[model samples]
Target: MAWLLLIVGGMFEVGFTTALRFVDNFRNLPWTLAFFGSVTISMGLLEYAARSIPMGTAYAVWGGIGAVGTVLVGMIFFDEPSTLIRVLLILTIVAAIAGLKLFA
Candidate 1:
């Protein structure tokens, strides 16, 4: 279940990051709350998962998930760049995350 927790925690990392864009420098009340709430939940889960998983692997996977998820959300909702190279790089991150899981 540690892996499941890690994945969920990583998803929350994505949530908090994507929510950050809508925070408007902490002026938007709802988005600001979302950002903080997600941050807490994500960190809590990460810490919990780290109890069972190796610290380095858990952290790296969490970062990879957050990075790739944030980029995809930005491209879909915020009109961020979606060039072929960018997509390929995101895919590379996915491969790395998978590699970490496989080798762990």
Candidate 2:
């Protein structure tokens, strides 16, 4: 359950980060609201998960998910570059996240 919460939090981390690009430096009210809302939900879930998961492991997994998800979202929706090296690096992060889960 804690792991599930952590995963959800990580996904919210991705959402908030992606929403940031649409914020237009906080001028866009809707996107700004999305950003704050996601931040609140993400941090809340992360804190809940931290009650059971170790801080270091939870933080690393959360950051990894956000990094990988943001890069994918950028490439698919925002015309960000999707070079081979970039993909490989993202995969590496995924692997590391998996490893942490496995060893945890």
Judged by lDDT, which candidate is best?
2
Q: Show where candidate 2 strays beyond 4 Å.
A: none
Candidate 1 weakest ten by summed lDDT: 2-11
TM-scores for all predictions: 0.96, 0.96
Q: Write the per-residue lDDT of candidate 1 for residues 19-101, one digit (tens) a residue.
A: 89899989999999999999999999889989988999999999999999999999998899999999999999999999999
Clashing pairs in 2: none
Error of 2 at 74 (Å): 0.5
Which 10 consecutive residues of model 2 have the lowest summed lDDT? 46-55
Whole-model lDDT, candidate 2? 0.94
Candidate 2 per-residue lDDT, tens place, 26-63, comes to: 99999999999999999999999988989999999999
